[model samples]
Target: MESKSKNAPAKLHLRSGDTVKVISGNAKGETGVVKKILVDKLRATVEGVNMITKHVKPNAQNPQGSIEKLEGSIHISNLQVVDPKTGEPTRTGRKLNDKGKLQRFAKKSGNFI
Candidate 1:
């Protein structure tokens, strides 16, 4: 179910455009940029990670059936944002920056991410 509240606490920390690491499953330790976030499903698709093969049936674009490989959605809990300063995976937290705006910070290096 979707949270109707705009101020609802974040249940997942990963976001699109973030460089994230796969912490578990088949893609463990692999890192990639987050391509998209499926908010309702609490999953994120990371570029070049968790790849899955799909059989595309004949369509307007594809005259003949073709096989394709693409990124697959991964549970948010399996992802961790890479620390900007240290280039390592770390837990993230929301905090006020120098500008007094809430931003994500790496717990390992204490750097704004």
Candidate 2:
């Protein structure tokens, strides 16, 4: 299914461990920290988001392999940054401060994401 979002989230600005919300897909409203970024696909896998289970065969580590829960990719467009201060979804932007250091800030709370 295709996501219906007002704006596509910028991919380069996001990183692992960043908190995000699923804004316009089947998983809308679900929030989680980014676990990995699939830049080639313009998608990301967020912890606890778009989870899927896969059955596995026996292995040396697990003798009897079992089903494992794993995260699936979600299009970057469906994700929105979660404000660290307000704990609400927000947009991210970069700005140069007086110190000449470029930093990312949350548009909604005006705080660092």
Candidate 3:
């Protein structure tokens, strides 16, 4: 007998180009734009936050091995959307306006995020 599996698509809450702040972590209070989202891992890569130094080995790509600073994946829960108008961390929610267009707004700023 064949069984039908029920699964839903992974939703990356923070999309690329969205501004966000590190809610709780070593990088707390730091804010940056969302660069990439890891759907499988439920993490997002925020620019200028969670900076980590990575060591590089001698390879064709890099003749000299050196330490490089790059962003590390942060759990989605550790991130909060930042409102452009108020410059505060806010929760994102969608609403259908009078024009029937879906828009994302910030709960704190009461403005489009």
Candidate 2, residue 3: CA error in Å? Answer: 21
Over 1-113, each residue of candidate 1 has an lDDT whose tens digit, in order, gives 75644456455688789999999999999999999998766789999999999999998888998999999999998999999899999999999989999998999989988
Residue ranges of candidate 2 with Cα displaced over 4 Å: 1-11
lDDT for predicted candidate 3 compared with the true structure = 0.84
Q: Give the TM-score of candidate 2.
A: 0.80
Question: Please, what is the whole-model Cα lDDT of each candidate in the order they appear?
Answer: 0.90, 0.86, 0.84
Clashing pairs in 2: none
Predicted structure 1: lDDT: 0.90
lDDT of 2 by residue, 1-113 (tens): 65433356444767888999999988999999999997767799999989899999998999978999989999988998899899998889998877999888999878865
Backbone clashes for every candidate come to 0, 0, 0
TM-score of each: 0.88, 0.80, 0.84
Clashes of 3: 0
Best by TM-score: 1
lDDT of 3 by residue, 1-113 (tens): 53222255464457889999898989998999999987766788998889899999989988998999999999989998888998888888888877999888888777865
Clashing pairs in 1: none
Highest lDDT scorer: 1
lDDT of 3 at 32: 93
